[model samples]
Target: MPHLHGRVAAQESVFARMSRLAAQRGAVNLGQGFPGTAPPAFLLDAARGALGRFDQYAPPAGLPALRDALGADLGVDGADVTVTCGATEALHLLALALLGPGDEALMLEPVFDVYLPQVALAGATGVTVPLTLDAARGWQFNLGALAGAVTPRTRALLLNSPFNPTGTVFTEEELAGIVALARQHDLWIISDEVYDELYFGPRPTPLRILAPERTFTVGSAGKRLEATGWRVGWIAAPPGVTPGVLGLRQITSFSAPAPLQAAVAAALPVARDAGFYDGLRAGYAARMTRLASGLRDLGATVFEPRGTYFLTALHPHWTADSLLDAGVAVIPGEAFYARHAAPAGLTRWAFCKSDAEIELALTRLAARPELTDV
Candidate 1:
């Protein structure tokens, strides 16, 4: 293991491990962030339409129609869009294209667990900077900490807006600070905006509008349409960055599923209707409110999620010291960070579940009130 690359070693399948645990224990799974339902009906039908027609491999840069649609949605030009298997492949491609041995990349602490391993695998050093959420103010990027962490060796900054785990979306001001940092350090900004459309309120415009050349956004059709298994995701970077992305795309999977790309192309025009995404935002907002209020009523502290379908609970008074076995399978907060990992008492939940499922999960949480005091 010592001789193996740091990236591959760091990259254990957290979701897979927890999924098996949930299956064995019959724990209510708030562990994974994907919806357990089939993708939107219209999107599914569109894929079926392409089965016999577009079933073959697509161009290495991705299908033009899908790429063009992705560009239109992100407000970038089509030349900047390149589709991949999922955000997983898109991120991997970006890391490979932009990073190399001895280079350094900065990441926010409590980020998606998959990222640290990917950065290490790319032969780059992973720098984890913490984002502190004060009970009164909410979660915020620690700019000073980020600034101090950057050096000439730092080549990129990877961030997910509408963040996972914490679900903290950046304000316009926060975006500016980060863009400034990128400009100051000449760092590539890898913006994971998979949850961009799942925001609670006020849809955020991608910062690529501000620094088009320096930012690469990873977008997901799966999260956009509750179609996690569809696995159609894309990378939208500046024209200058496309060649680097293409270079990696050449050796790797090369292209995405042609049928899924066609489906995504068909789904895009429908998915981008302002009213459609607004309805999505509102529904998730309602769910967040429901779960946050429920957890609070049970005397558990809830960290309200802003963008993604996730929220954190700080069981400040839990008696068991850990909550994994309490018929609820929320991930411990420590799994998200490399340093200052929470020892226990913090759990991450997925609100992407159906309303009924969320209610049932809440009931299970209420049933275990005694565990909070142990």
Candidate 2:
């Protein structure tokens, strides 16, 4: 067999492997960040309606109806949108369109693991600026370090608000700083707003308002609507970036799945359902509080999350020499970073589980000394 070129090890996904292991062991899945629920009922009915009626392929860009709805939500026009299979495809397509050899892509460390491999696959140098969490206060961005990481070779900066893994939410002011820096350097800004709807605090406004031309915002119905299986996500770019993204998307995926697109399109009008979203946010917030309080009760220091569906903690006492084991499974913080690797006792637990699941996991963690403090 011939060896394939451009195969980067960084492209390998550990989350999938971990998820498979969890399934095989019948372990709770805190490793993977997927919702465990169905989408809106109206959306499902809409998809059913579209089936057979619209079984054929959609336009290469996307369904005209969906694009229009998305445009209204994003405060952009239909001409500026291109729907992809999911935010994953949208991210990949954007990478293909925006990055090339010698161009450096800058992002925060302790970031999404996908960024490393995707950037490498794009034939671009990846520069990661670390976002260290302060225990005294909530996890915060190291702004000075972030600014210093930007340079002449930097082509794009990827920012994820309501960030995954750490759950650090970016403020409007922080986004303003990022926009200012991008403008100063003429860099493209790729903002992943997949978790924008999962916020526990005031929702961060879109950075698109600052520099619409330079910003590419990625949104997902999977995350917002609890329909991961539906796999409907879109990229909202300016008119200029849309052409490039459309060019890449055609060959990558001519169009999103028709039935799923229909479902997503139907769901868009009420994605931010006040009653549903408010309750959902409150539910996750309660889960977070429970998990954090439980960890503290067990004498572990917890890193509080302001947004997103995760809670991270530090087990400083459980070093390589003095290992303390929590019987429950979690993703190690190191999994999300490229440098200054997260140390032993540093673990991440997801709060997206139901109250019962959360209580069970906490009990399992607290009662089982055999699993920790080696």
Candidate 3:
């Protein structure tokens, strides 16, 4: 057998593990983040109608129309947008452009799982600044830790607002501090804003809006339109940084699928699309409430979700694997953190499940009296 690279050969993702377990057990899965719904009817119609529209490869930077739509949506110019396979690809491209061996990237702990891997794939060291878990303050960003984490070797700051697992939205005041730190350290800001539109409280300000020159922002239609399988996303960078992204794109996947690009372009929300934003928020908010309420009734300490489809709750001693044995599957929160530590007793339940799926999960969980005894 041939040798394999350590980083590339790492074990299957926690998602893959939990999903396989779910299949084996036939458990009601809230373990993975896949949304249960499809995109709005208009978006689906656009895709279905695009069957024979454009058969050739999209431009390496993406379909020009899709780029333009993303530009307008992001308050940037079309020329500044580089569409990629998905937000994950966009972030990896940013890391490829920003970091290399000996460089250090700063990120929050319990990050979206891919952040660290992307940093590693860049051959960069990832330094984590944790968000403090405080009931009074909610999950608060620790600026002091961020300030302390910076060193001369720090090359980038990877940030995710409306964070996963915690669901804490980074406020303007917090961002102002981050901006100051970035300015002081001359670090590139690779902001993952995939869940930005899902905010339940105050809207989050994209880091690009605050520091366009130094920030590369990533967004995805997968989350925005609930069409993960379509894999349409864009990286909005300042004019100065886009050439590097384009260069990376040319050598990579070359371009996203054509029909999906056109479909996304057609259905993307513009300033006039009030109904799209309103309806999206209302639907997800209802799901979050239902899931959070259900978990609370089970004596779990549920953190009210501020954004995204995930609801984080504390389990006294339950592992997601054990939960699968109980016929319910949720992601064990420890999987999100980079460093090994005692499990935080947290489980992130994806409320993106359909109403029936959610009810089934709740019903199964409710019958497990061992859950509430904790």
* Candidate 2, residue 260: lDDT: 79
Cα deviation at 239, candidate 1, in Å, is 2.0
lDDT for residue 287 in candidate 2, whole number 0-100:
80
User: RMSD for each model, in Å, please?
Assistant: 2.4, 2.7, 1.5
Rank the models by TM-score, top first.
Answer: 3, 1, 2
- On the 0 to 100 scale, the lDDT of residue 81 in model 2 is 89
- Clashing residue pairs for model 2: 323-373, 323-374, 324-372, 324-373, 325-372, 325-373
Greater lDDT among 2 and 3 belongs to 3
What is the TM-score of candidate 2?
0.92
Q: Ten consecutive residues with minimal summed lDDT in candidate 3?
A: 269-278
lDDT of candidate model 2 versus the reference: 0.77
lDDT of 2 by residue, 203-292 (tens): 778878888989999999888777777778899997766887787888987988987787777777865554667877887788889878
Structural similarity to truth (TM-score) of each candidate: 0.93, 0.92, 0.96
The TM-score of candidate 1 is 0.93
Question: Which regions of candidate 3 fall more than 4 Å away from where they truly are?
Answer: 270-274, 340-343
Instruction: Give lDDT tens digits, candidate 3, residues 178-225.
Output: 999999988899888889788897788888888888998889999888
| Full-model lDDT for every candidate | 0.81, 0.77, 0.84
Scored against the true structure, residue 40 in model 2 reaches a CA lDDT of 60
lDDT of 1 by residue, 1-374 (tens): 34864434444466766767777887777778877556677787898898999988899888899888887777788888888889999999888888889999999888787787788778888888988866666576777899999988999999988888788888888889999989988889999999988876677768788788898999899899998887888899976668767888878887888998988998898877736677777777888899889878877777887789898877675522234466656766778878656534677888887787778777877777575443
